[model samples]
Target: MSPALVNNSVISDMNTQENSEQRYRLLIYNYLSHKTTAEEKEVLLDWLKQSEENRKLFSDYKKIFDLTVSSDQKSRFSYRKPEALKRLKSKIDPSVSDARRLKIKRLKYYLQTAAAAILIFLIGALTSFWISRNQSVQNLSITKYEVIAPRGGKSEVVLPDGSKVWLNAGSNFRYGADYGINNRDVYLEGEGYFSVMKNPANPFVVNTSGLEIKAFGTSFNVKAYPEEKFVITTLVEGTVKIEGKGLNLSLKPKEVVVLSKESYEIKPDVDKVTTTSQLSERTGRDRSEKKEDISFSKSVQVKSNVNTNIYTSWKDNYWIIESESLRNIASILERKFDVTIRILSPELNQYTFTGTFYKETLEQILDILKLTAPLGYEIKEGIVVIKGEQKRKSIYDNFKTN
Candidate 1:
């Protein structure tokens, strides 16, 4: 053959191959849209199995078709699929030879098919970008902030609303970045002294495990230790309301409400003060004092004189115990010093201690307790074991008795 004829034949083969690929792509679109004939479906499947690239191209088109259909349904697009396909087919030229005209006609069909395919691809890309952007916006709406006062430590945090929280030892406080905007919400564990900034429209809410204290521009002390049986809310400067389990109590300044697991009680006399030293003397007494029964009456009010400073002074790092029990003091020391305290003597557990210590070492506090009470302590392996006066008998004594 001549060189010119050979080049013409090669060009013709290339054009035929391109026409076949264009027809295959259109068939794939029809197959995805459930508009293909049985023979066309068989041809599409065979072409997909011919090579990995062909399979990938079919897969990509199918994904775009499904995404576009779903997104169009959600967005309520005005363009119908049949109308789009019909409008695309009307623009083909028909005035050529039979075989060449068929090729050109299919070529025009390929361009129209590409227009719809590209439209669906762009719609899917825009939908994905919109969804991801919405998710990013939702994530940015609220930012969480947390403050922890570890054992033997105290911390102060000023919230976004200019409210100040003084966290005592072993306390956790958390609030969100949108704190003052809609409403001021804070979660508290253990104890916190809050001086809330007043916002009449957006009330402040302090949440504990048992109850919630709602306040507006008020200062209060909350003692909600997980180990303790009572949630104590003491109002210092402003009025506040405590609510839990269908019970509500409105508290005035210098008043305190104590919420137990089953009931709630109010102590009216915040001034009646008893020191822990006075209670310590009564520790070794008879049966009645040993059982500290918590009153569980819903919304029951009782009058007792308590020094309000004793409850709120921990904000100043002062631990004031007027008449607190040794068992209770041990619990406080455990959190304050971050140490385990074991009262070996059951009798010693009932003993009470009363004192005030600011920035005192655990050893220093223990030394003071030894002087004031019949208690001996041994610090071993990160634990303080308090022993009573009755020492254990020697093993030789049992042998001698035998």
Candidate 2:
């Protein structure tokens, strides 16, 4: 027999199965055609309950049938059961051995199984493609917004969650559109005073270059200047948790945590000092090698009587300097005046000045420095040059009266 004749004989044998089996096959066909009567659906449900294999086979056949008869394929090629049967019969030669007919029956089974497997693979591939495409769209929907305070300028911004932020001169703040909804996250460069709104469930997080500050309904000041070697976080109200390198510390009201760029000698009596051993324990490093490899020291939590206003007064348009070095003072003036300041004398850099300037011009502030410290400043264009003042000799001294 030819392959088509043998395949027809196999189909005939399937139709000659027990009544229940034949009814099950007919129910599967009815489901594929979407024309199952209520009684046929009930019978199919009972058959599916007999075994897991039965349910799986039925599902695979249903998928294959749906794919074959889909509208796109139907428009291109009309498939009719009678036409398919006629084509098979016309192609078959009715003179062959039984052995050849058995082989043809096995081939028909393999072809049906392969077709079902291919349809399943295609469905899975399309599902995965759509899932990835939707994820990309979601990522594109998240927009990032950045606010910058120019040199000698200060800005105030309101976040999407109604939190208020005061950005100091030369500061930058950024947040995304999904900030409050998914996560209240912000990145800060330079200084910012945040008055966070209380949402205990979603804590507000402020990320600096080296530290992360998590706060809940709190007001705090973060000073992390790129030029400076320290990142200082001061909590004025509520509470905040600070994390950096291998340190995690919590701050209360009027508490300050300082993160330095250099390792310092650990003292026994210091307040909440994180030692090299503690760092090694957290980071899984040899204590000796850890110290040398770590650029930033463990955070130092200190209790001081120093006025907090000196650190936070800049947000109110006031510069409260108290015994701060001229080098540090010059840094402030540069930002306040939006000008470049060069100190010619290294000795002058250490001279400490204490005063408060409110709405003062660059020349006026420079004059105040001259009287308090033996420094002379000259401004040409936008740069200010500061040098030590020279002393004048008296006429008697010049004549060598002694």
Candidate 3:
């Protein structure tokens, strides 16, 4: 099969960046099969030199090529030719005899090149790399697969077990090589929405910052950005168990749990202080009368009867914000639009807004916001500076006093 036949759908579904990625992938495939032209080899070499990430990705593909297209595999493909060739040719359309002939010629070409095109498709990045037929991936050194959504864009990833994950901007999701074969656990940073495949025996776990969300089969959204003070888990459908240090909670559909990071950070200090208080009480120092002001504790709040869409809607094109403060909204807009936002006026942070944005540009959203409040904004060099309209602020302040 031609590389175009294998990557046509992939190129169509992805963005321009992904289309370029597919082109390079084909180049890599051609290069490994020893069919690269002089120009294609230079292009691949230049891409490899661009970054460590590109080099690492190319290295992974090279490893896959070495494993799949070895001398023994070549001999086997050469020996078991009749059945496989017949099965491949059967898929060709009877009406397009010329096309069928062309495909058959391509198949023969692949045989001459010592690599199978269908094998390339099967071992592509979209699917899990099956190292060997006789052994499990667990028996081999684990190869970690990482998918990162850039700061300005979101990414969709399909796991080995058909579990789909939509990562928000500036997010990273990863899993081990033995993902579907032996385990179904994934690590997440930033935020991701998961629509997991139903596997009752094998549980799916999303590991965040010191927190583990275990689900048998469920759809849920996890927001665990490092800058944020809380790790939020919102269950959309089915049930999920949230577990961590001094925290274990089960969430039902439409329920959201917010775990404070301060609680996790102060556990050791809290334990020490508690121990000291107990010792003081045992020593008869009258410490019971002197109350220690320690504000840290295991702060886990589970809110019921909530609109889960408010939390999970970020993954979609239209984002719905409900009574969110300007300060918080700025952060969301920054991630969504991939811009730097700065709030100049402290009073603007006090104002809250509620709106549904439908793929609006940064300027359009800002225009709508200006009508709701005495807000002024300036954009230069991709940085947005938001301030209060001084004249309007004065009128608003007077109106508030009255």
Candidate 4:
């Protein structure tokens, strides 16, 4: 298309936006003036059909108009115009160009014309709109979302922007409930797997603790806790950027970025520890996306491997530990059950464990722990107790001694 045509199209779009607001005001005026001619009605219908946006604007205008003007208000008009319109008025000094004196009119008539007359010329500049007077128009654009998982229970929620979140037992997360026309954002606590919606233009963002993960659209897992110092972000598929404190790193699929708890930092590194899901996705060959000359390979590898199932274990209603320090492992148990676990033997912290279990009750999980280590634990009320095996080294030892 020629520049001339492009300019004309943009001008037309602007004109259409302007015409929408004008039509709304006109509709209200016609209703008030009892001048609803067939031609005016046809014009209204035409505008409504131009775009769903036009209908939304029209409906919003009628709501505000009816709310501000009623039977009692019929005798007097008191139109304050939207704040956006008022600001535009100050920008264009309507007093200088379009000022006129009319004969004495009733309060309602004068009020209606006073704002409308000034607003008529400035409508083009007031594109940001306000509707719903009961709730600020801004509130309706985006809402707040919050989800919490109780002890031993977990939650799964799909956000409005099409991102899926899995909250671990005893964990919670909050997000801007509404994904606006141009952007999506969320906040996380503990750990969760996110299969984010893809939008090549606008990136999805997850903010947690001091870390920020940004991606156009991809699947990833983030683990951040206020009680704990470290924040770990693992990329399952697609690309992501991790930024926190004074550190920032871009990651590839199969890579994990661990920001240090003590210094809140990460030395630059490339990671490539494969996941089960990543293996499943590399199956369908897309000719268009593949390049013959370029190598399809990993520039960097991961610090460790993550079983897609165990890495995303919270999503599957199980806790799997693979050579994980007992302290970190217990913390996961704490978050899942919303309880504090005191390690009577902090030396147990030095021990790393590897184990997997299906969905088990809280008591069952703790029992499993006792079988693997010389520790006795019990849940009284909601508190969990971690004790050394007294004089008995194990459940068998206690039985033998008895």
Query: What are the lDDT figures for the candidates, one per model?
Result: 0.63, 0.65, 0.70, 0.57
Tens digit per residue, CA lDDT, model 2, 244-330: 655666766766666663433332333223442333222224333434433344445344333566777777677889878899888
For model 4, the superposed segments whose C-alpha errors exceed 4 Å read 1-142, 177-180, 265-305, 390-402
**Candidate 1: regions farther than 4 A off:** 1-141, 262-305, 391-402
Provide the global lDDT of candidate 4 against the true structure. Answer: 0.57
User: Which residue pairs in candidate 1 collide?
Assistant: 272-305, 272-306, 275-322, 275-323, 276-322, 276-323
What TM-score fits each model? 0.54, 0.55, 0.59, 0.52
The residue-level lDDT of candidate 3 at 271 comes to 30
Cα lDDT of model 3 by residue, 1-402, tens digit: 354544444234546786878777776877888766666667678889999999998988888878886453355355436534544565565443333321211011111111223221111334343334454544576666666665666766666555677788778777777787767989999999898878999999999998889998888999999888778899877889988776667777877776767777664433322333222121224422221212234355555657776787666665888888999899977776667999999989989999888767778889899988999899886789999999998898899999
Model 2's lDDT to the true fold?
Answer: 0.65
Residues 1-402, candidate 4, lDDT per residue (tens digit)? 233442333223435757746555656455445555555566567767989987787777677767786442352122213323534674588562232211111111111111332111111132223332554656465444456544445556655543566665555666653454566667787777787767877788888876678987787888776676556788777888876565456766765655545444333223222212232222134422322211132221233344444576556454678877778777876655556788887766766678886656557777877777777887765677787675555564677689
Which pairs, if any, clash in model 3?
none
Worst 10 residues of 3 by lDDT: 104-113
Displacement of residue 135 (Cα, Å) in model 4 is 15
Q: Is 1 or 2 the stronger prediction by TM-score?
A: 2
Candidate 3 has a TM-score of 0.59
The Cα error of candidate 3 at residue 268, in Å, is: 13
Off by over 4 Å in 2: 1-140, 262-301, 392-402
